[model samples]
Target: MSGDIQPDSHANGHLNGSSERPAPLTVAGVAQRLGVAASTLRTWDRRYGLGPSAHVAGSHRKYSPDDVARLERMRELTLQGVAPADAARAAVAFDPAHPEASPAPSQLVRERAPVERLLVDPLSLAAAAVEPDPRRVKRMVEQEVEDRGVVRAWTGVAGPALEMLAQREKTDLPGVEPESVLRAAFLTAVRDAAVRDDAAHRRADLVLLCADESQRLQAHVVGGGLAEVGVQARVLRAEVVQDPSQVLDVVDRRRAGVLAVFGAVPGAEDLVTAASERGDVAIFLVGDAAPSLWLPHVHRVRTLSAAVEEMAAAISTHV
Candidate 1:
């Protein structure tokens, strides 16, 4: 770990030349050193009042040495299994002069929420979603997809975070802004990735459609992952086609051999039944909220990776 910047003296034995205080670190700089996201720091500051002491009217908040020390202590406590709220309380009460006086009892208790066990730091992406700059959030989503690919990134990070955000929205009454921003950014990123230049040459035999508008994002993510590995999955939103026959018409016209339906749309069973009549089309039920009713040759997949794999295999075989 890097040492915090001090204002006591210069590196040399001589006294410092100026009387001005050392400039406090920005959120990004402090976040980099602390091994956490800048948004996470902002969230801590907003929720726990552990913000920087050096504040300007028009500028970003800056973290002084003491502020950074408190944050470091907060991180340490949280890592030792303390709840964030309790950890923040302990961190705020921490005294720099007395190192041994840190909150050992809270750390020893190892208090954690049930949600934390389900997903590792699910609030990170949620925090990023509420950032002042939507562009930064979008860029972060694109970068995560670029680095981790659509399937893993969505499953491991975006999916869990969005789920947690939804739960928070229901219980905490946090407005829909955070979840909406994150979903839009994620959908935009994945849809951009799904676009292929050689679309005319490659046959898009896999058709993905969600009956519910809420499930469209997952469908797009699955389609995007399939596209990454040479399968150009055709994604259609529920709003575009109200009637099951409309999707069936596209499937029949395009000679699409694989059809994946997502979410609990009203006419999904009817659509699946019609699609099943055409023995050539392989049907797949994708996402958690997909219809439970199953027919012969119908496959069910609850995850993005699973949906992509099944659909890709079906497409490859059909082509």
Candidate 2:
């Protein structure tokens, strides 16, 4: 990593001149280093006053090492269950210039006592969902995704909690609005996992679409799972596409190598028929609601994990 950092000629004076300070990084460079979006960094700056400290005339803003460190701390804290506003405040207050003044990563983990308690057992998460503490539930779900891969995290924690919520809804339980909380948290995790930095994989066209308008969650699961293996997918919600032609347009535009349609919503058969007509792209049918009558050239799978494996295999063979 040290070798990757080269001193800027402008910062370091001429051959005979004394060496100057190291060059700060641009927004893109810092974003790549931190594994976050450049827009996210901009948002932090605008909202939390965490912008670059060093500014050169007639040039773009550049972040010093200290600024990077502070932002890194903020990201770490936010991911570990700290509220963004609170995390930003703490990060801004931290003295990144003084290494000893900053708390260790382990200390940060220890600070999240409430969230830690919720993650102590699977039963605790389910119990928390009964009362529906949205913040706690979101944090637990995020932590699970970080610890386990997307597939395992969804299947083991988020999926079961959601199932419990469905059961509670059937009984008309009070204070249970799990849908909004779960959807937001799950989408956030999916965005975080779906990093498209690899040039080779970026061109590999893989699309995951929901067959039914209400069955959007399964598409997210498949997208997240595909992301774990470094495959980026274009996720199309069911409502976004009106008919088979629209789905075909997306596939053609993306030059999709593999297309996985999830859910058992109405008109799925028509969509499958249209996709099957395209001989080049491998089509897959996934989820419990998948069509009972399997058509030629359509690969069917029951679970998200299986869909992920099938997608990976198709990409490997076809792309």
What are the per-model C-alpha RMSD values against the true structure?
A: 18.3, 10.4
Task: Report the C-alpha lDDT of model 1 over 227-312, residue by residue, as the tens digit.
Answer: 66556676776654567888877887777778888888768888888777777788988777777866787889887788877776
For candidate 1, the lDDT comes to 0.70
For this target, which candidate reaches the highest lDDT against the unseen true structure?
1
Quote the positional error of residue 173 for candidate 1 in Å: 13
Pull out the clashing pairs in model 1. Answer: none
Tens digits of per-residue lDDT, candidate 2, 47-115, equal 466767777764545787678878887888889987776788777767754545755444443344444
The lDDT per prediction is: 0.70, 0.68
Candidate 2: regions farther than 4 A off: 1-122, 169-176, 196-201
Native-to-model Cα distance after best TM-score fit, residue 26 in candidate 2, in Å: 34
